[model samples]
Target: MLISMNTCSEISVVDCKETAEKLNNAKRYSTIIIVGRIAIEYIGRAVSYAPEGDRIVLLKPDGSLLVHESSKVEPLNWQPPKSISLFSCIENRLKVKSYRTNPHEELLIDFIKVDFIKICNIVTSKLLIMGKESDIVKLIVLNPSSILNASIVVGTDISTPYGKIDILLKDEKENLIIVEVKNEKAGISAILQLKRYLEYYASRGLSVRGVIVAPSLTDEAMAMIIREGIVYIGIDQLINGIKDIYRDIYSYTKFKT
Candidate 1:
């Protein structure tokens, strides 16, 4: 049977073990969604609430933290500091503390009661795929018929003021194309990010077009795509087309050393 700290008068040895197990898995997954009672204290502040109650907290790999009290879209508190502090478990309680030197600011969070924990591997995999999409986009851009006979003439994974473009290419017509790759569902935000890159290149007086490559797009995103006049390509098609070109090589190489 699972032991809950909420029902018990005090945290038990079993509860500590459970928290340890969840925290270990959370480290492996790189993100943790924890539901429990929590308290936040900002030390040495003139006016501070130091809220304490049942809350859902998200611990990210980059040391970002978010606390939510209700099902509202916005979080109760968000902290994405420059550096992430260490997390320690003491007396069956989890603690996180952050300190700043210049401003002399310190934040402390304590988890008094932990009811449930969820390791967010879905978003973790999406992040991994986001990194690989750069390579896949490069493979797709090299094919003649893939981008309407476009060939890559510039550096890939190009850095811009908005963000990094997954793959940059120039078509036979000498028009520059900005490609943004998303393995998961493409939403309006993704389109907006791609548009930022498009505008950046367009401002340089070059003939530029933006293309969003993703597995699928939301209905609202599709409407925006058409209205925005940006090109869209399904990742499945791009991958399968590349596989077709390299299938024989893979099959032939598999039997060899």
Candidate 2:
């Protein structure tokens, strides 16, 4: 039977033979964690070794392996995903070795005495992020006048020779506005893109204003935007506006049977 996610079992003070067999048995679909005194040896482009010390060894189903001592956040030794790991017994110690083929690197840990071993069913899910660039565009599209106090949205994703413009708007004064949306800090490249869009419309004899919408701006980008006469809309304001839009959704509660 497949173990449920987040379920873990603890084994105490097992010998090398038993520890090696148990870890190897679950290596395919589980996450194995072993705590013990160990000596580490690594061979790749460089060769290094760690003398006997208490450490934690982690093996993940995705082929990630790591060795950590009681230290900082960074592991003493590690191998990223897709690494092949194998377990075996060497004399009186348990040996855990992990390797990758492309560069042909290897990490060996010799466990002299294990404190405990914990085997867990691995669980993973996709990560979701709000307030993305697309989310910013959606915010503006749903509320045309939310940007630059613009009265209406001309359109979005308007095509150009260089790239597609994010959003086109018209201000209260009847002037066209070119908007380039960025989810994070705006930069010089963003300013340049807006300038290009402004120039594109200008060459066609159109009176257009350029605006950058982002969470923040870099020093260089802020200076450049000032020099080029561009406007900036911070995500703080956009988020406030979004809160109002999502207010009803916020009040919603799931049904309880």
Which has the greatest TM-score?
A: 2
lDDT of 1 at 95: 71
Clash counts for the predictions, in order: 0, 0
Local accuracy by lDDT, each model: 0.70, 0.84
Per-residue lDDT of 151-173 in model 1, one digit per residue for the tens? 66466778998888887888778
73-168 in candidate 2: lDDT tens per residue?
999999989999989988867898999988989999888878889998767977435557887787788776667544688899999997999998
TM-score of 2: 0.51
RMSD in Å for model 1: 12.8
TM per model?
0.42, 0.51
Whole-model lDDT for model 2 versus the true structure? 0.84
